[model samples]
Target chain A: MARASLREDIVNAAVEQFHMFGFTAAGVKDITDAAGAPKGSFYNHFESKEALAVIALERYGATRGLAALGDTSVPPLARLRWHFEALRDENLAYGFSRGCLIGDLATEIADHSEVVRKAVQDSMQQWCDALSGTIAEAQQAGEVTKALEADTIARFVLSAWEGALVSARSDKSAKSFEAFFTVVFGVVLR
Target chain B: MARASLREDIVNAAVEQFHMFGFTAAGVKDITDAAGAPKGSFYNHFESKEALAVIALERYGATRGLAALGDTSVPPLARLRWHFEALRDENLAYGFSRGCLIGDLATEIADHSEVVRKAVQDSMQQWCDALSGTIAEAQQAGEVTKALEADTIARFVLSAWEGALVSARSDKSAKSFEAFFTVVFGVVLR
Candidate 1:
């Protein structure tokens, strides 16, 4: 494989492992083998497994979470709903066996590892920023209500969705995901 | 320590380790050392580290999580708020360095370990049950909306609080927790 393709392959493989098994429990050897890359090349591309894991989380959010939130044609609140629905679908796709890479890493990765921890923190902030912007627009249009500040509600909505994902993964059920949507739309915003 | 006290100490130590280091990364040796007990004594009390980890999770929930939800004097939603605020305070005590042990274990512990996963699942269900009862009462009192089912709302609130905890640990800030409370009470319950 070409150099660029090999690097991308390694990162993709690592992200899959981190999603399935957290950043800490997942072995680098398994990651490399999945990528079909040699062990020596993993070091050449990244400083450590933790570094690759961070990259994986950011990439996943950009492609999956942020992409849905950034869709402008959809109404702002609907876009927010879309973002969570996509996540719920993704979790179900995994048979509720795994969870968000960022949320999982924040809980599983060692706190002593500053770099990895910061990466997880930053990724979460990025989602809040994305959702917050849409929430601001929704508030202006009266779709989300003006009772609370856009930023605060945005953060709260993010927490509920993430928490719902936590329950989904732990219980291996879709009940938490469905219930989360009902409250957020049928009650909170309504 | 007496044999029973020694077992309690070991379990308490294991709980702390699981909170700090997660289920898979935390070692048996460290749990014993933290308990100031011998390694040999560990297996004598518990069949495996997995068994001990499950017990630790159950114990923590009884004292911290379920206890707050089970408080009868407080109104339903306020009791739920109390439960999350208590958790937020506990996280701040740790400098926002760790997260829920059950959440961490659900993502960290290997999926094939059915016993440990079931323990995490059941503990979550227990909280959902406790919250659902209070929610039904609140709905009857007109404190919460009649639009959503009490059981569904209960599950969503729990997920949101748990998800907020995830963010609190990730950002090392109380922002998510504060936002969670504001919207949950001000919007959903209102």
Candidate 2:
């Protein structure tokens, strides 16, 4: 229906603005204006900004997960590498204009917004879980270190990747990503 | 003497507000109110909110560096562990309400504010340099692996710690910090 499409538009706009300006700085008016939707349409779709943020976080997590899972035909380690490369390209395309949306929101609202905080927590856990699966497969394939437990190594890899993203954002350079990926995966492969 | 004290108070207040509400959401009024300084006094001391932020960031970095250095009387590896433990306790005491001020500001303003972005980059590089020195000392003392260069390990440690903070903030738990430190350092020592 047209109404549902409008709602999706509003949520997408909110996610982009919220990622750029953060939850407190990005107002409902700004989201509506960016979406080209009437103000009433925003309220009609979501009860409040907090409610809207919760939905936006979910959408973002789902979309990113699907994109990262692209072409399962590739070997798990190579697929994982592809995912990081895609992320690097996306960050560069944006001119390093934003770090991860989940990261930004987690830092900004984690202490205050319980709903938003849970959404971020869930997204990160899900990411760790997905990476864990790939790592387990790699271990079985003898493509990665078998000495470390799969789950533990997965968590380490995820944490290192997130940290590299933060460094990349701060420096406005993708070199951090390159260095991190090389060192982390290099150790496993060796 | 009074002028120096007032300026320090303003910078401290701005750092607190920025940590709580981020760069864009935090305003001059919020910082001035927190400092108990008059509005005119704020403008007389700083040209703009961005100017105040830069000074506050420098103060924050210096304080954090001193805290991280601690006593330095213990063994090299032990000293490094203690530094992380101190950071863990600080986060727990704050109820994880605050993350690294530099990390928070870098995430929020790096994309949009060139001055703030460069300040964060410079501060992070300084932090990396400091940590690299410690790692080099530890390696020379046979406290860690020499297979990886000290600077590479330094980058890994710093990035992992930052990521652990993000995970801690999201999960509302310090377990991520503990897990990351144990695994990364465990591997290094082995």
Model 1's chain B yields a TM-score of 0.92
Clashes of 1: 1
lDDT of 1 by residue, A25-112 (tens): 6788889899998888889889988788778877887775676676778898898887778778877888887677777887777376
lDDT of 2 by residue, B148-177 (tens): 887887777777778788888899886677
In Å, residue B16's CA in model 1 sits off its true spot by 0.8
Expressed as tens digits, the lDDT of each residue in A44-125 for candidate 2 is: 8898898998888888787665445535677878877776677778878887767788888888888788988999899888
TM-score of each: 0.93, 0.91
RMSD of each: 2.1, 2.5
Single out the weakest 10-residue window by summed lDDT for candidate 1 chain B: B103-112
DockQ for every model, please: 0.74, 0.62
For candidate 2, the lDDT comes to: 0.79
Question: Which candidate number has the best DockQ?
Answer: 1
Q: Ten residues in a row with the worst lDDT in model 2 chain B?
A: B65-74
Question: Model 1: runs farther than 4 Å from truth?
Answer: A1-4, B1-4
Docking class of 2: medium
